[model samples]
Target: MIRADIDPKVGGHFLVIDRRPTGDAVHYGVFLELRRPRRMVFCFSAAEHDHNADRIQIDIEPLAEGTRLTLSHEMCSEWGQFEEQTRQGWVHVMQGLERELDAMQVVSVPEIVAQVAGEPSKASAP
Candidate 1:
């Protein structure tokens, strides 16, 4: 989560520090195409490398309950053998996101006021 800056336009550069089980690695690339809030096409690789490793395409589809995410990573033939490991890494990252989403909560205005005034919040009154 170190970098979340997207230009939301075509040919925009993007860089981020990616932390994974393999340790912290930076993801560096540029956006190839941007379709607003629906889809994004970006090519990235380890910051240590001189060239790109994968071009990731993300497609978001709205659903009844939530949203369906389709992620496709296109990589070089040289990196073909580590595909399973790459898949597992993505799974780990998504699980982390899910946990964070679960802990998200909204505080009401009253609650904000109480905290600001150093006053305890009252239960819903009759």
Candidate 2:
């Protein structure tokens, strides 16, 4: 099973907390990436199972106030069978990500404006 935790914080940053289990093994990784409200790109990889898995790339574009997120997994041969499952798995995760991003809009807009105003962002505040 694959599990993921997403926390969309202040500023244009988001955190990806993920864990995956296969047989007797578990893999985990965290991704922090920049987002432009409706657009974003992040780095992601699994060390335990597919050590050679390349970083995943995500792009989200605005669609009627909401966003459409597209995820691409590169260097698939390195992951062997895991590639297929990973692709399918992302479909589900992307859905959740969209929901989270949608919810984050409430805070992200204000944070973005505050940053544009040249003030210290809450994300960077001590």
Candidate 3:
């Protein structure tokens, strides 16, 4: 991402600008839920496709070795043509999250936001 303006509290808003190979992509959304260490739900959409905004839900579960993050994105039917692209985007994002977690050894809202914004998180283990 090129830049990010985020407020992670429930009902808060976020704006993220990503620099892709093709061009710059802008995404913005509002936080719907923020159950720390458990789940988060937010409205997600590109600036151009804001009319078809989708809700993305992330569920975090603890495991013996580590944590498992399950993501569900309920996209609008209007984005059918971009379905594959969207799926790839999610995959790429998850991969990035994994990389960030590996580097920071933590997973939280602030760290996640930092990861997406291409910044190293200052968050430490609690």
Number of the top TM-score candidate: 3
Which scores better on TM-score, 1 or 2?
Answer: 1
Of candidates 3 and 2, the better by lDDT: 3
Tell me each candidate's TM-score: 0.66, 0.46, 0.78
Tens digits of per-residue lDDT, candidate 1, 22-46, equal 6877777788878878888887776
Give the higher-lDDT candidate: 1 or 2: 1
Give the TM-score (vs. native) of candidate 3. 0.78
Q: Please, what is the whole-model Cα lDDT of each candidate in the order they appear?
A: 0.60, 0.43, 0.71
Error of 3 at 85 (Å): 1.0
Each prediction's total of clashing residue pairs, residues at least 3 apart in sequence or on different chains, is 0, 0, 0
Estimate, for each residue in 1-126, the C-alpha lDDT of model 3 and write its tens digit: 889999989989999999989999988898999999798999887763365577777887775566667777776666666766877787788778777767775544232321222211222112
Assess candidate 2 and give its lDDT.
0.43
Estimate, for each residue in 1-126, the C-alpha lDDT of model 2 and write its tens digit.
344355454222222344445343334333445555553444344453334435444665545444445555554344555644655665566556556756877633211110111211122111
